[model samples]
Target: MTSTVDTVDPAAAEATEVSRVVISLLKGVVYQSESAQVWTLLRRFQARVTDHMTVMGLDLVIDEAEGYAHLRQATFDEANIPRLVPRHRLSFRVSLLLALLRKRLAEFDATSSDTRLIITRDQIAELLRVHLPDSSNEVRLIGDVDTLIGKVDELGFLRQVKGQEATFEVRRIIKAYIDAQWLADFDARLQAYLASMDGDGEPRG
Candidate 1:
C-alpha cells in the first residue's frame, strides 16, 4: 500500500493569514495594543486586504498614530451596490456626549505628553452637567450620566480601565471621526443650543 501526503502551499498559507486579518477588521475595530500579532499581519497585507474590502464597497480606515483600524462604507456613487454596513443614527444627547468627549480629547492632546486620556465618571458628569437641563434629583442626574457613558462605551470610544471603578480610558480613535472641521461646526451649534435653553436650563425647541 502507498500513502500520499498533501502539503499546504506557502502562498496559500500567507493568503489565509491575510484573510484572517480582513475578517478581524470586518468584525469591528482592531486595536494594535490588543493584538500585536494581528496588527502586524494587517500592516503586512494592507494592500491585499484593502483590495478585498473595496470589492465589497467598503473602505478601510487606519490611523497608525492612534493604533486603530476600522471599516467604513465606501462613499463613491455606486447606486447598484447595496450597503453591507449599516448606518447608525445617534440620539441628540448621545451626539452631544460624543462631541464633548472629542473636545476634551483635543484639549488633552495639546497640553499633555501622554497619549492616553483617563477620566473618571464624576469628571464626565461634571463636564456634561452645564450642557444638560438642571434637575433637583441628584440620583436621577447620576443615572442619566451613567446612561450616556454606557452609550459612549458601546460605541467603542470609551474603554473601562480594568480593576478600576468608574474610570475609563478615552480611545484616541475618536479623533478620526470627529475632526477639527466637525468640532468647529459643532461648537457654533452648541452655542446656539445653549442660547435656546429655557429658564429651567432645558433646551427649548
Candidate 2:
C-alpha cells in the first residue's frame, strides 16, 4: 500500500481549504452561480471554518439547497474582535420593501410550478402599493418604488435579470435571514407601519 504521507499532507490541505473559504466569504456572498466548487469546499470544511471565524466574532450562514453562504458578525461584546461585517441599517421604507419582496418570494415558492420566481418592476410596485396610502402623484410614487428597488438590488436581495429590463430575480438569502419568526409577526408590523405613516402620505416616527 502507498504511504499516507506520500499521498496527502493533512495540515496543508486544511490550511488551503480554510484560506479559500475565508477569502470567498470576505469578498461577499458565495452563490453557486456557475460552479459548485466552493459549495463542496464549504461543506467539507464548515466545522473548521466555523471554529476559525467564531474567534473573530463572525458566523457562517449556509444553505445547501439555496446554494449560497455568507458571514455575519457573531458577537457584540465590546471586548470582542471589532465587527468585521458592519450591520446594515435600513431605512423604514427599505425595510418594508425587503419584507414585501420576501413575502412575494414565499408566495411564489408555494404557488408557482416554475423553479424560479422572477418579477417585473411593475409587479413589485403593485405589490407595495396596496400597503401604501393612496397618492395623487402616481409618477412620483412609481419613481420612489424604483428607487427602493434599486436599494434592494444594491443589498443583493434583488438581482436584475440579464437581458431583461425592469425585471429581477429575488435572491434566496432574503428568506434565510428573514426567518419564520419574523414572518409570524409580519402582519402586526405592517399594521404598525400603516399607523406610523401619518395622514400626509409619509411614514414617520
Candidate 3:
C-alpha cells in the first residue's frame, strides 16, 4: 500500500480560515461569544474582509467594543445592479417588540451602571402588554407572547443567562441594527398598528 503525504501551506490554510470567517459573516452576524475561532479570525482578518466586501457593495459593521460584527448593504439605493446581502423584513408585531426591547435597553443603560441588562420573561410580557390590544383569552395571549419572545431569542438579541432558564441578558449590539432612523420610523408604524387593533384585539394593518 502506498500512502501519499499532503503538505498544507500555512498561508493557504490561514487564507481559507479567513475566507470561511468572511463567508460566515455574510450569512449572518458573528458574536465573539459564539465561537473563539470566529472571533480570533475576525479580529485578525477584518481589514482584508472589509476591503473584499466593499467590492461587493457591502460594508462590514464591526463593534469591536461589543465584540460583534455583521454585513450591511453599502447604501440604500433603488438602482440595484446586484446585491450581495439581503434585507430582513420583520413582522409588524416583531418590529414593535424589538423597538420596545431596544428602548428598554436604552433606559437600562441610562439608569443603571451595569454593563448587562438582565430581564425575566414576565417583565418582557408586561412591557409588551400595554402596547397590545386587549384580548379576552388571557392564556392564548400569554402563549402567543411567549412565542414572540422565542423569536427574539432566536434573533440573537437576547441570550439566556447561564444557569437561568427564564432570564435573559439583553445584548447591547441591538443598537447597531435598530438605529435612531429606524426608531423614528417606528413611532408612525406603532400608531398605524394601534389604529389597526381597534376591534380585532391584534394588529390587522
Indicate which candidate wins on TM-score: 1
Best by lDDT: 1
Worst 10 residues of 2 by lDDT: 133-142
Q: Which residue pairs show backbone clashes in model 3?
A: none
* lDDT of residue 11 for candidate 2: 96
Query: For residues 111-148, what per-residue lDDT tens digits would candidate 2 score against the true structure?
Result: 98765679999998887777776666334566698899
Better of 2 and 3 by lDDT: 2
Task: List the candidates ranked by lDDT, beginning with the highest.
Answer: 1, 2, 3
* Cα-lDDT of candidate 3: 0.79
Kindly indicate the candidate among 1 and 2 with the higher lDDT. 1
lDDT of each: 0.85, 0.82, 0.79
Candidate 3 residue-wise lDDT, 77-105, digit = tens: 66855877666677766777789899888
Worst 10 residues of 3 by lDDT: 196-205
Cα displacement (angstroms), candidate 1, residue 36, comes to 0.9
Instruction: For residue 164, give model 2's deviation from the true position in Å.
Output: 1.1
How many clashes (backbone N, Cα, C below 3 Å) per candidate?
A: 0, 1, 0
Name the regions of candidate 2 deviating beyond 4 angstroms: 1-14, 33-35, 76-80, 137-139, 199-201
